[model samples]
Structure formats: C-alpha cells, structure tokens
Target: MFKRNKTRRRRSSRQRGPVARAFFFLVKAGVWFVVLSVGWVLLYKVVPVPITATMLMDPNGHTKDWTPLSRIDRNMVDAAIAGEDGKFCSHHGFDTGAIEKAIAHNQRVDRRGRGHIRGGSTISQQTAKNVFLWQGGGYVRKAFEAWFTVLIENIWGKRRIMEVYLNIAQTGIGTYGAEAGAQRYYRKGAAKLSSIEAARIAAVLPLPDERAVNGATGFTRRHGNTIAARIGVVRRDGLDACIYR
Candidate 1:
C-alpha cells in the first residue's frame, strides 16, 4: 500500500511538471516585457528616437531631424490634431468612438460590396506603432500596438506622445519628421511653418507617400483648408489643451 501511494505521488508530480514550467516561463516573459518596455519609454523621453522600422525599411534612406515639441510650431501641432485625431487630447490611448465609427463605416461599405476599409487608430496608437512596432494589420501587431499605446500614455503623457508622433511620422517618401519634411518641401524649418503650410503637411498624412506638400492640388488643397478651419475649433474648444499647455 505504501509503494502504491508513492507511485501515485510520483505520477502526480510528473503530470504537474510541464504545467509548472509553462507557468514560470510565462511569468518570466511578462516580467521581461514590462521591464524592457518601461526602459524603452524612459530612454525616448529624453533621447531623440534614433530610428524606426519605417525609416529603416525605406529604400532611399529617409531624412529626419529630431526637433523638440517646444521648438515645433503650434500650428503644426494643431494641424496634426485636427487632421489625424480631433479628440487626441481627450482620449487616453485608444479612441473607442472613432473605432466604432470606422467599424460601422467599413461594415456599410462591405455590405455595398465596394470601398476600402478605414482605420480609426488615434495619434497615440500611431505613435506606439511607429516607435515600437512595425507596419502591419495583423492581430499580433495590433495587440502589441495596444500594449505599447497604454504604456506610453501612462508613462510618457500626451505631450510626449504628440512630440514623438510628429517627430517619427512618415512625412514623405524619403522624409521622416516635421523638420525634414519642411526643409525638403518648403525650404524652411519646422518651427517656421505657417498654419497653411502646416495644414498642407497634415493633409498629406493620410497618404504621405502619394501626396505632395509643395504641389497641393484638388483634394489635398480642400482637405488642407478643412484641417486649417478645424484647428481653430479644436483650439477654441480646448481639445488640444492637454498638450498645448
């Protein structure tokens, strides 16, 4: 009877070994992920992010000059907020309303059997993707994007998110950041960009590779004007107060 009991205990221990190992592995991975993410966020808080996946993947090797938020033009900030995410300052990391709207729009378009699907990623989400993750539409990439977005929102704040977004966003085919984009197109510094110029820059954000900041025409011009108009609305309504202050 004692030998039988010992055999049963051994069997139980063997059964539990893999489960315990798996659990410990998961815990270690989670701890490492948290530590590494926190360290990366803290590093970028001061140092200009040297490179992004997008920049590295660019065939021509893009140009980027890291300019601080204080040095960047307020109009550019307003334009970005207006053109990309009107509720940027209000939303924490994700924009549920925009996501819902985009979902509804896509569903409607799907039902019609024609039209491109739209994305509802906010500036914070975009910054998280641009800075940490690669460009893609898979569930895995999106999951990582969400994780990093939450981290940056909690650790970096709205100002840092905006600053990083403006600095890392793909402004042109071979241009990265507002400074490079401004100099490449307008022959001026990012800090010196006017509202209209900034609006034009923001107008190309949806498809920066295909659009031109200097050669504004048709939809680009109209969209830029619309963004310029909305900038005042966002400012007056305090939608940008979180970072502007």
Candidate 2:
C-alpha cells in the first residue's frame, strides 16, 4: 500500500500544472510558426509563387501570366509606384506616416456617414496579405499580415516583393497581374505597355472589380491620368530606384 502511494505521488509530481502546460504549448506553437514561416518565405525567394488565396477564392474566375520583372515594362513599374505606393523604394515594411494619416482619415470619414476608406498599406504589406492571407480585415488577419510583411521584407527585398506583388495582385474582375491586365484591357503584353496604359492598369488596381482599365471614367480616369503624369516624376525623383537599381 505504501509503495502504491509512493508511486502515485511520483506520477503526480511529474505531471505539469495547467499554467505550465499552457506556457509550453504556446512556446511550441511560436517555434513552429517561426520555422514554417521562414521556410515558406525562403521557398518563395527562389521559386515563383504558383497561386494565392485571392486567386483561388475569386468568384469571377481569374487569369494570370507570370511575367518576369525584366519582361515587364519600366513604365508599369513607375506607374505602380506613382499610383499605389509613392514611398515603396524607401520604406522598410510598414509606413507609419501613411498609416497614421489613414487612421485619421478613417476616423473622420466614419463620423460623416458614407465615405471612401483610405488605406495606408504599403506594397510590401499588400504583397504579403495578397500572397499569404485572405481578403477582408480582422485583428487576427491583420496580425498575420504584419508577420508575413516582416518575413517578406527581410527575405524577398524590394525588387522581389514588387515583382511578386505586380504578378499576384488582382488587376480586374477576373484578371490577375500586369500581363493579364494588359492583355485583357489593351490586347497587348505587359512588356509593351506605354506609360498611359500602365497608369490605367495601376489605377485599376485599388478597386479592380469596379475600375475600368480600357475606357475608364469618373475617378478612375482622373486617377489614371494623374498617375500617368507622375510616372515621369517617379523616374525623375528616383522614387522607384530600389527595384530599378
């Protein structure tokens, strides 16, 4: 009886407390997340991304052609910087100033009923979210987006990130990438895009389903024209130097 009691005491002593068990579980999970995320980023650094969650989930179906950065026109690259992220070449991962401005704009818009939502996401953040995450916003998704943004910024660098972003981002109702957008809109290849053509495509990027790349009107046309003009300024000011360099 004493031996049985001694054995029971030893077994109970070996068992972990609830707090200890939870701590160990979280530690294990964190380690696995780090390992797997690093591996995924490393894999994509060398291998072209085959597809993304956004592509698979698009209800309108999708078209894509993976045009290498070298094949894509310089105009397209400049348009993307001008139309989307003006400071793409300078920021690390997050753009705090843009984020702060977006937050303030959103707060002000919220009190005014219906209004356009301003976004502060950088190209890196967009690429990370588009490649590794689903559409829509939530704290959990935002957390994951931040995690992957850091991973890509560290692993892929600016050129690769921009390359992947241009290829993966939704450019129309069913079109994905500059190559597909160019073909669908103008019946031309991405490599042959002029500044105006590229800017129109870039203007379509923010709201691909709604914006018309070919005969854009209203905000889309105005935005495209603005971006088209800025393409030269982008080159002149070297705003897109990182990817070009």
Q: Per-candidate TM vs. native?
A: 0.90, 0.94
Q: Tell me which residue pairs clash in candidate 2.
A: none
The parts of candidate 2 lying over 4 Å away from their true place are 1-14
Supply the global lDDT for candidate 2: 0.92
lDDT of all predictions: 0.90, 0.92
Residue range 1-245, candidate 1, lDDT tens digits = 99999999889767877879699789999999989988998898878899999889989888999999888998999999999998898888989999999999999999998976888999999999999989879999999999999989998999988999999998988888988889998998999988888999999987888888887898899999999898888889988899867
The candidate that achieves the highest TM-score relative to the unseen native structure:
2
Best model per lDDT: 2
Across 165-241, the per-residue lDDT of candidate 2 in tens digits comes to 88998899989999999899889899999999999999989899988987789999999999999999999999988
